[model samples]
Target: MLSRLSPRTWLLAAAVCAVLAAGTSLVYGGARVQPASWPQARPEPIALGRPPALPWPSHGQAAVAVAGQAGTLRVYGKQRPVPIASVTKVMTALVILRDHPPGGPSIRVDRQAAIESGNRDESTVAITEGQSFTERQLLELMLIPSGNNAARLLARWDAGSEEAFVGRMNTTAAKLGMKNTTYTGASGYEPTTVSTAVDQLKLARQAMKDPVLRDIVATARTTIPGVKGEIVNSNKLLALPGVVGLKTGTSTPAGGALLWAAHPTSGDRDRLILGVVLRQGEPGDALEDRKKAAFVASRRLIVAAQRSGWAKTR
Candidate 1:
């Protein structure tokens, strides 16, 4: 009966078989067939342009360090040891991360950090005593808001005493060759705690290497478990382009100081750029002006580094 079919019927039956015998394949008899071959094309590489010029500002001591095969720095008065203000928290954070990994045990906030926060009257996340937070969360509180209380908490947690933690800080600084650096407290609140711009830069470089600390400092704002609202970053430069983590400081002696870093991005193929601005603003300047001076100074150095093309070896 199959062999007796007419020519057109045979053709139609073959087409039906072709459609059904494919075992649910997409190819059909009436479907348009596309070309099996295609033209080959490769995307052209982008040409790197000349770096823009970076103007050196006159009001502050600053430096810019690039991270790469040949890390170089453009600096002004980086050798002078001065007060780093709250920038000490960077060291506090780095030391804590070095000893205790990010996901370590939760530490209950003691009244000491809260009492010290109120006594110092500096920036704080207002974490009450008996409130529990992970080491990572405590880091966010310390670095993001420049919380002195948080620094003290980490210090005590790590060394069992603030003095002992500070001792370790000095030991670490010495090991890192921060010759001009000194630590009197976990927070940079003590005028006695001092360091050169370059020394802080060294600390910043180390801090940026840690994923947990890097992520925490890069956050613009974060809410503490017990705190009511977001504790924003004290480093105002964080809002600027390419400006990322590290720390900031301001005090009667320290003036305004900032340790800032820039990460790699598609638009800027350059390596990491770290900038530090120390002793900015006039003695009697407004509070915001003092703060803005450090931020602006740090941003200027970053602009210069970017303009000069961080890829070029000095």
Candidate 2:
């Protein structure tokens, strides 16, 4: 073939062969080619300064954090586990909603519930035995009024026994990374039900994700069937600006415990702030006084958090 072609034509064929070999080499090469911008590394946004100092309570334990974000923003007082009172109902509500959704079948008010409701020492929503309420309604009774009986009833209905339901509650706490939490009862009536502020703050972050729970906790007051007067949310912090749902717990052993969630007035609506204040005062103090102390401390923390721009920051 080389002898048959003219000199100029042979040179042209040789050039074409070289070009093909180059193309083949490029195709078989292990190196990957990409657009200039595609391979360039992006600079990560750096945190500009330390997290602003929050006005943490001087007594008891407290923690503040943000939803959809990791880690606590600030903490105060002791971090050890202590009685959490009715805040235990938050876990109960989560478990109920997990096993039985909002609109599921109604649960009958049992003798235990009626007995609990009649007790003068505990917080409860009065209900007659044999009367029934749906899952959503029962949740309202449990969370809004901080009903002790309603919590236990929902626990039993979900797991066939309160003890069994408490096991589930502990399991759920462990799943949520609440290592310092322990649940001996769904109602949190027993002094044995204990948790730390940091642990409860973690729970607040997760519980607020459920829209149903969010709605119920944010409700300040509501009327339920068979209940005479309107039932009010124990979390008085709901009255504060941008404040939303969460829960409150109070008992002789727990003192006053609160877990709260909120958003800033002038920031992204999706941004949520979470807080927990526990054992605000001496346990032997009047229940209302102790609860008021918790509310006051939480109010200070939330306001300080807002002023410090927690909602707008990372």
Candidate 3:
């Protein structure tokens, strides 16, 4: 049969034989191959450092003020020039109260004041032009609601022009030992409004000493009639335990910052500790982080005071 096969058949048969041989070799080669082995070792465990003794404020720049009956201590960062947002009103309110005092004549909001007030921003106390409100109401509007209009109105009332009033702000800050602080506007909307965490601490401490300022800041809610409607206090931290009162600030550039004062219900207290954080995160988150940082620092200070016999137990 092999001799009877044609050349074509022979070629086909040879091809089939070759394919069969390749398949057999492949099968044997695959079976003969063995997996490689590796050396085994135990995984190392990671060691985390000790947690911070005190929780630090999460914001970029944070200032905390804790007041008691005793002395005060303030820790802050590089006294740099950064926008303060609505916190500029702190100085405005102080200057206004100093000039007008509490229960003084009412402030009339005019066109210029309203025009210079609010802008496209996250927070504002809308006050229309031609609105009339008491000096006390204006103070509340400035501090409680952080009304930009209120700040501008008070500034205009004080110095005749917002630019001149900012000059006054710088002058006042200098007098108060806030060497690093500077003001370009009453509402801190301008990026030129700058102060350090340390300088803000100084300002907060001074503001806290004023009975009227303290009372106004501690207030959780207030009503102030405006040209269009009534304004109300918006600082939610007033309701928090141990919170006295201070101020909250926010801006796109400055981030969310706060000057907070807190104290235990009873004690030979400590003076306020002021903390300021610049260029933090979102407004809400930054405020919360600053509060937490203030709480932690205050608690630590309280404990230290007790241990060092600085604060007497009730």
lDDT of 1 at 34: 38
Q: Report the lDDT tens digits of candidate 3 across residue range 205-275.
A: 78888888888888887565443455455555556555666777766666665666665444444434344
Q: RMSD of each candidate?
A: 15.7, 10.3, 20.8
In order, the Cα lDDT scores of the candidates are: 0.77, 0.84, 0.65
For residues 158-200, what per-residue lDDT tens digits would candidate 1 score against the true structure? 9999999999999999988899999999988898998887787
lDDT of 2 at 286: 94
Which has the better TM-score: candidate 1, or candidate 3? 1
lDDT by residue (tens digit), candidate 2, 1-314 = 65888989989778756755454322225764332232225677765223458877778999887676554467888789899999999999998888887776778989888888888888888898999888899999999988888898898889999999999999999999999999999999999989999899888878888889999999999998788988887888899998997898888898988888888655555788888899987756898899998999889888876665656655
Report the number of the highest-TM-score candidate: 2
How well does candidate 3 match the true structure in TM-score terms? 0.68
Clashing pairs in 2: none
Error of 1 at 73 (Å): 1.6
The deviation in Å at residue 101 for candidate 2 is 1.1
Compute the lDDT of residue 194 as modeled in candidate 1. 88
- Show the lowest summed lDDT stretch of 10 residues, model 3: 46-55
lDDT at position 178, candidate 1: 94
**TM-score: model 1 vs. ground truth:** 0.78
